[model samples]
Target: MSGITTSFFLIFAGAAVVASLALYTRQPLIIAYIVLGAVIGPYGVEWVTDLKLLADIADVGILFLLFLLGLDMQPRALIDTIQKSTVVALLSSLAFASLGIGIAFLFGFTLVECLVIGAAMMFSSTIIGIKLLPTTVLHHKHTGELMIGLLLLQDLIAIFVLLLLMAFGLGEFSIMDFSLTLLSLPLFVAAAFAAVRWIVLPLLRRFDRFHEYIFLVALGWCLGLAEAGHALGLSAEIGAFLAGISLATSPISQYIAVNLKPLRDFFLILFFFSLGARFDLGLIGEVLVPAMVLATTMLGLKPVIFRYLLHGLSERNSLAWDLGFRLGQVSEFSLLIAYMAAGSAIIGREASHLIQATTIITFVVSSYIIILNYPTPIAISDKLRRD
Candidate 1:
């Protein structure tokens, strides 16, 4: 118990000092958290060596993030965003996948490795996309709607990819397994709404005046649905999203969203820290050249592709470019795909290492670019700091 407490204390205290230094150096606090993680993680000082525990800690933050996204999405806006972005997301994802496939092929990866790497490239980091987004932008702008729609759609696709990969890895790709995967999502959605309408709303009404109770109930609802999603073979993030969207029509939705920010940020710091902590610097030698090429292409091309597609669809130039820059990074899903593929022996250690190294590179470099040049909640410059 004391050991756990001490480790957390170190994490937090280290975060504070690093964050202060980041501010002094005009760097994003995100860089600070990640750097602190690498320094204290098993790869460095070995203070926190439990990757499983780190992932669990990270996932909670991401769940809250998706939940908060749902909270802000009014039904009409969400529907419109989905309608507008479906084509854009599909096309953009295809382009990204092709880039990965081409790169992997050129580097002499096997067919399976090429395919898996391509699959991983089809997503942008949801946490990076939304966390850096200014609240004012998200609440008031069309850009927000499109980015949200794209990120969510990409996430759904990423989940499906994992499911397919899982079945492939187990060599049990039956019709029944496929059917269950397809059927589970809508059923879970329906169940979530029904529970919210029938059970959650009533409880909230009964305890309308009790702020503390409302808070507790909100957490319970989110975590409960998340667990249920996992049990149903979906995902906790998806479930948390459903939990938030189900309550979107409620009067207290914004109140809940507002109150959850602090706790969400608390977990998010750990999430970013864990990202750094888990990075294997030893892979740098084996994967450096490919990782650099991959990261550079993603950072340079993603924005261009997104911009052209959006512009072709008649979006404003500024908005198109902004959205492009905001979303032009590899996803957390990419790392997961590589991990799963490697564990399943679908890819070799070299391929997995390349994917991991590329992802970390893009994360750090892309973050620096965004913070230095664009408007974000944690931008280094006063002019760029939308917060």
Candidate 2:
């Protein structure tokens, strides 16, 4: 059996077990996924070997994730997302990044290492936030809207950083190159959007009559555009997202989503499992103090910064607190940032591993915290409002 095939079986078996446990305990299944990964990983009973193919599939998972996010977005929503959440995301990200870098500096990490650590800490996991959101609440409340907005902001920031990293070479950064790269974003997006509308849409519309054809067309558009984006020095995630958005108005969008769910789930499991198995516990051990320091800062300080941002926007303290508590954990994109930075050699393996470890720890802890306290926080807000 192929290594990737074995890994998929293991992940599927793990997910099934976690699903049962999550149902029994009334907890999120995502936590179960992480815990399962840890249990069957290199640190545990060694089962799977080949990770390269799984890693590649995980990349597809990321593309689908971005695509789904875009599918949920509407053009009219951008103004509101930016106005409500842009400043909040930015301020929160800056505060977390600063705290992360400061802790790294205090722990005697190099300047480059500190920079990478800080940058990695700036993003929060849109995937978790979106997946965990109550669909009922999302369709009803201001808080849900704010959460969605915040996630969109974080996604944009992550994409920009990815673009920057891709544009830069092995040597030090260049102002001219950076300027050119930034200028190219809108052009690339515009061109992609235009091509999708004028060319891709017609072909997809015809193919929509056949279920197999619809699925193939959707996948082809996503992958084809992703490849085109890579060729043009943009992240494939960007193209995949745009592809989803382009198809959002089509009647076949829902069909595509339904068809893609199993594939997405399968690959996403690989993505998360690979994330866990690839972690360098040795480096984490070496940088134990720094890792702990950074984790503490994220857990302690991020919420406070977000609370302040919310309060500044005239939100009630209690509501701000709920929002803060919900967003306190570092995002999944933080891992992606670390992975990219490590791959690019912008930071050492230890620094990247430290960030990833902190992220996983924070994600597990924060998910529990929010799940437990969500109702209490909302109730407290209502009490405060009445008072």
Candidate 3:
């Protein structure tokens, strides 16, 4: 077998064994994936050293994940969700950003580092929040709508932040440049909706009887729109999401969603693995103290802040608390932002390491808390485990 093929075999085989052990021990399976990556990664046993290939493949997982989320949401329903959750999302993000800025300053980070870290902290993990949510709740309950809405809003914020950072990286940061980039968002949205309404939807309706063809077209459309978005200076993720949203009202959307899940999971494992494999264990020690402090603070404050915001928005206390805990973690976007900022030399290595370590730490701890206390697909108790 080729080296990459051998690495894939090692990764999947290792993942399967570790996943079983995680289930047996009543731990979140995601933790197993990360641990698997670390053990066999270049820094560990050197079983897999092709980090670039894995990272590139892993990005598809994020695209599919966003696409599926868009598939689940109807345009009207999404609008309603945004209306209800907008205030909460914005306020909570500001609060989180403030917290991050304060911590970075306390640690004596540079102004640029503090600002970038602060922006990174403003998001919660869409993957963790949605993956752990039971389908019953997701499909039939208000909780899912609320969670999805807030997450969508945060994603928009994350995208804008990434664009700004990109501009900063290219040394082209300016008010006019930022304004023009922001303008491209609505323009893309308009163009995507028009294309879907006139072209994609008609084709789907015409070919509705052919399952295989329908699946192929859906995949093509998702990636095509994603590429177009990137060409227009937008993120592929935002483009793919809009692609899903455009088709959300179609009768065939649910069918597409159900079938795409297995494919999405395949990429997601690679995403988490790449995330783990990229971590340099040796560098972690240098930022250990600040990372721990930042992680602990976010974990403690997120739930409290979310609960307050949701309750003020007239959500029931119980429901607000549940939503709060579900979203109480640093996001995968945080890591992405940290990676981008560090690569651009906008943030120091220690600052970047702090974001990464804190994000992983929160992922593990938050998964444990949510699984134990809420109904999830992998909850330890049968009563709490709902698909």
lDDT of 2 at 272: 69
Best lDDT among the predictions, by candidate number: 3
Off by over 4 Å in 2: 25-27, 137-145, 163-169, 315-319, 375-387
| Candidate 1 lowest-lDDT run of ten | 1-10
Candidate 3 wrong stretches, greater than 4 Å: none
TM-score of each: 0.97, 0.86, 0.97
On lDDT, the stronger of 1 and 2 is: 1
**Candidate 1 root-mean-square deviation in Å:** 1.3
| Model 1 spans with C-alpha error above 4 angstroms | none
For model 1, how does the per-residue alpha-carbon lDDT over 237-313 read when each residue is reduced to its tens digit?
88898888889999999999999999999999988888888877776788899889998999999999999999998
The stretch of ten residues in a row with the least summed lDDT in candidate 3 is 173-182
Q: What digit string (tens of lDDT, one per residue) describes model 3 on residues 231-314?
A: 777788888899899888888999999999999999999988988888888898898998989999999999999999999999
